[model samples]
Target: MKLSFEYGQGLMDATLPDTTDVFIPGETVQDPPFLPNIEAATREAIEHPMGMKRLGEQVNADSKVVIIFPDRVKGGFQADSHRKVSIPILIEECAKAGVSDRNIKLICSNGLHRKNTKEEIRSILGDDIFNRFWDLGNITNHDSEDWDNLVDLGYEEQYNARVIMNKEVYDADAAILVGHALGNPYGGYS
Candidate 1:
């Protein structure tokens, strides 16, 4: 068996023995049946989410809403990617709450990784979204080192972990995080 893996600026092809055990997520282990309409499904989830109020009930016209997305290395990057699809739906929900696009911001939660460039961001967010927010300077990459923009909300001695967060996220009236359900998208070690 042969496979082509994505490498630095190119592909790396490897040949594996037929006896080699290989497990590809959603392949070797089946995922649930695919949603026929991801956009509709996403909207439905937001409308009637469990354990929380609906998205439109969370904010208002004067609210500053920040949508946080994982950096380039995470998630699917297709035009119909989770990031691409879910973000628009989230913005629509915010709109339903009377939040204007002018009051909305997008941040890439890069953590310790190098910042993603405009091209990289555009690829991840798609042209329509990038165009909509880039001109307004509402899209930005997370800077963990920017002390002035970080909030250290006291240390948690029990967990031996400090609760540090980006001020934009902490201070926003509403903050939405788009990430993988199976992965821990928050907190990391330098």
Candidate 2:
């Protein structure tokens, strides 16, 4: 048997034994069109956010904003991808909130995975964002191996695990996580 797997920019066929169990979402499930008008819906969501202050209410000229997004592993390259649609809106809102472009940074939370290449980053962020921030040194990826950029949250006594985060995110005045909410194998939930 052969099955198609979603890969970057395209799909790949994987051959498996005939007796192997294969599960496909399309067989028994259908994902409804959650938000048909992404831009309008995003605007509405920002205007009336649940459990948090609106973007304009929280940021100011002095605020250091950090916008984080996952790499090109999950979100597709479609024009309506979260980064493409929501980022411009977020930037506009931040601007209205008095956050300057120079004070805002874009970080790719690639985590332990390899840093996304320039092309991959471009594809994920689109031309407008990539061109605006790439040359300005305002766009970057999280380097888990860069100890200086990692902040230790101390050891958790209950879980016996130490939590760490990117220092940029740790030090930001405001941080926004923008990405899809669909299922992913790595996190079980996105």
Candidate 3:
């Protein structure tokens, strides 16, 4: 049997045995209802997250915060995207907890993907956030190739390897991850 499936920006034709199984969200299965109010929902989730303390409660004055966001590959940055809405609210929470605006930093966690330029990051982050942090040099993309930009987390006995991460995240007193999660074959993607 032959079928067309989504691949990147378009679709591709594929041939498979008649018994092969194929499933797609909102196609083979019902799509979950869209959130009624994305902004409010995001705010609510952050302020009253499951099992975790409220964002504001975890931070305080003199705290240095690093907010890490997904890259363009993760598909955020629409007008009402979680990043656009949630990030500002997170900043507000930090501010409410007495963290200074200057102490807050935003990082694009690009991982193995190519480093996202400031312009590309702006597209993923929207104007208000991009402009707010960009000029202050508070927004930057992860550069895996830079030794000085990475922080060593020391050796992990369980994994038997050293764990390292971005220096900005390591340096912050409070590190926050802000991104979407997708259920997939790999368990989840963030």
> Per-residue lDDT of 8-40 in model 1, one digit per residue for the tens?
457899999989787666878777778899888
Residue-level lDDT of model 3, residues 32-59, one tens digit each, is 7899898888888888889988888888
Order candidates by TM-score, high to low: 2, 1, 3
**Residue 82 lDDT, candidate 2, scale 0-100:** 82
Off by over 4 Å in 2: 1-6, 14-31, 185-187
- Report the Cα lDDT for candidate 2: 0.87
lDDT (CA) for every model shown? Answer: 0.88, 0.87, 0.85
| TM-score to native of every candidate shown | 0.85, 0.86, 0.80
Off by over 4 Å in 1: 5-10, 23-32, 182-190
lDDT of 2 by residue, 1-190 (tens): 8888767567999999999776656674665557778889988997889998998899998999999998877766778888888888888898998888888899998988899988889999899988988888899988999999999989989988999999999999999998777777677887
- Give the Å shift of residue 101 in candidate 1: 1.2
lDDT of 3: 0.85
